[model samples]
Target: MTLWNRLLLGLILLSSCWLGLAVTPSPVATKPNVIIIMADDLDSRQLSCYGGKNLKTTHIDALANEGLKFNHIYASEAMCVPTRASLFTGLYPVRHGSFQNHKPVYDTLKSVGHYLADLGYRVGLTGKDHSTKPKTVFPFEIVTGFEPNCVAPTDDYQLNDVRKFITRTNQPYCLFVMSINPHTPWTVGDTTEFDADKLILPANWIDTPVTRRQFVKYLAEVRRLDEQVGEITRLLKETGQDKNTIVVFLGEQGAQFPGAKWNLWDVGQKSSMVVKWPGTVKARTETDALVQYEDITPTLVDIAGGKPIAGLDGKSFLPVLLGKSSTARPYAYGIHNNIPEGNPYPIRSIRDTRYKLILNLTPDEEYYNRFMMNAKQKDRNSVWFSWIDQAPNDPNAKRITDRVVKRPAIEFYDTQKDPWELTNLATDPTHQNRIRQYRQKLETWMKQQGDAGAALDIVYAKKKE
Candidate 1:
């Protein structure tokens, strides 16, 4: 057939397939590629598109401009292993048996790798294999490009393997391009670009020289993460998979700052997810529909023409992605077990769109994280000591330090008015009713997940090989 005649016939066939007249299973057309780029220890609120006053994340903002930005996505457990374990398995931390940092998911559990691969997709992960355990459970084609170590001093990476993986024509791909930027030792990106004195600090942080220096490093990595986003999306476009791929950018928990990583504060549990599904998800839009890391795998499964895996803690939020629903869940839950990272302090939280309730399972004990609060470390920037040093004169610094160590039996905050959750309204008589309801809901969820709360923290958890 002539070239023009063949092109016309191809267009007619595609039109008939869309109209359900002739539904032939075209592997690439039926199953869109899924590329997920996750940032390590990311404080997503620092991104300009997320109301950040820091440097404009031009690359990530471009994705938000071309796709949908999620406002209420959370990490559930706030720790690296627990959060990622929950994400890969679609189960809460306790249920998956990775309730503590560095802990492994249950051996018998199934991960997104198994689920997506079972559905005929080439599932793979490139970096940060914290959740890729028990190879029998997670059989991802190990791609190489990004650095996998979170605390590596240098984050030099090449995209040769990444380009090859996305360009393959045999099957649709679900690639997790996890970036270990902005993690501890924050030495990956360009700190020269940020003026430490002029940057906007978090509402709850104290302005200290050490803190500012470290923040410049952290924000630089955030910029690096955005650059990686730009590179990956550009690869997709060059390979002609941009229109047939769903690009998801995840700010994996929060940064490794004292009050952010191992705690239950909003800064710790809050995460970000931006989805770009060309011709499917609406562009230049935002959603307040609650979602968590646990919901990610289920949504990917749904998108790959598979049903929601029953018995999973997360449900598919594809409806929210497609703008078919305004809400996904009534509440987003958070869990924190501070054993491996700190003293035995367990926290459970539940938040709706407006209010957040926190239950400290061991309130009498002071909370402590050795790495974040260390005062004796000389080689690296121990910013926590500077906060303590300034606390004597600066009341805000004192409040911030005290806020990290001290605790209460119950803490509640109106997240709508106080996004940082600075004030504890648990004692307010007017909010008592709402607090009680959230408490009941949180307790029920804990029970459902078989979470022992403070008791689980007493055990010393170790990483699995």
Candidate 2:
């Protein structure tokens, strides 16, 4: 047969298959490569695209420019393990049995690894494995080299390991490039880049030498993280995988500063999420849709052309990603179980775009985190001590410091009016009805999840490997 005739026959066959004259499947690839680059101890509000004026995150801003940014995404639990556990499995910490810090996910539970693997994806994770163990629930090929702290200089050599994985893999890949940036012992990034005297501190932060010094280091780490992200994106482009990959950059939980990481307030629970899926997701778009870490697994499952597992706590936010839906959930929930790292102070919270309700289960016990509480340690910064010393003269500092150490049983804040949550509205007569509704909703959810609240905190023991 002639070459032209053979080409014409192939076209005819393809058209016939599409028209149902034949039974051949479509030739186009349906599975997409997925990459989630998560930055540890990073805050969404500190990003340039998120109204952050102090630091210029050029690379992260570039991702936001090329993808969709989610404004109200949250971590199910504020700390690393719980939030990461929830992210891996489409279940809250209570249901997954990994709510406590440094605890493993229940042996019988299934995670994203099992779900995506079923659809023929080669899943791998690199840098910071804070999620639960037993390795059965979350099985991943570990990529090497970007495994150190997040403040380390962004080196092109570190990405060589990830580059090999993306270029060598033919089957769909789900790569998690988790960076431990801006975490405590923040001494790896460029300190000279940020001027401690000129940086803008958080409204709730006490203005002291120690506070400024630590924050300056934290911001520098964040900048380093941004450069690392740029390198990954560039790798995808060079490898010709950018078009077929869905790249998601997430600010896992929030920074480790007071009222952020270990608490259940907005700063602690909220995370910054930006997703780029060339043709599938719209670029340069923003949404205020409420999404939680729990929703991530189901969303990935759905996007990977697989059935979402039944009985999962999270539903897929695919519609929101596609710009077909303006909202994902009516409310986002948060939980904080302080044990193994601090005093046993359990907290549960719920928010619906505006108001936030926080229930401190062990309000009578003064809040304490041994690591943060110790300011005189050689490696530790003295922000905590400075705050305590300046409390008498600075009213705002005193108020913030007191709130961090002490708590009431019921706390409510109008997040729309006070984004920082400086004022408690639980006692306001006008907000009584809304407060009651949220409180009841949270209690009902706790009951459904079989969460014993304060009892869970009391019984939490460090898991044995």
**How many clashes show up per model?**
0, 2
- TM-score, each model? 0.93, 0.92
- Model 1: how far residue 351 lies from native, Å: 0.6
Q: How accurate is candidate 2 locally (lDDT)?
A: 0.86
Weakest lDDT window of 10 consecutive positions for candidate 2:
148-157
Single out the weakest 10-residue window by summed lDDT for candidate 1.
372-381
For candidate 1, lDDT tens digit of each residue in 12-49? 99999798896666764478889999888899899989
lDDT of 2 by residue, 1-465 (tens): 999999998999899878889656689765899999998988778899899988888888888898999999999898888888888998999999878777778889889888999999988888887673678878888788676434344422387788888888588999998888867667667889988999888887889998898888889888888988898999999998989999999998888887788888888888899999999788899999999999999999999888869999999999999989999999998888887778789999999888899999888889987667765572465778889889999888789999999999999998889999988988999999998889889999999999988888865555566
**TM-score for candidate 1:** 0.93
* Clashing residue pairs for model 2: 150-180, 150-181
**Scored by CA lDDT, what does every candidate get?**
0.88, 0.86
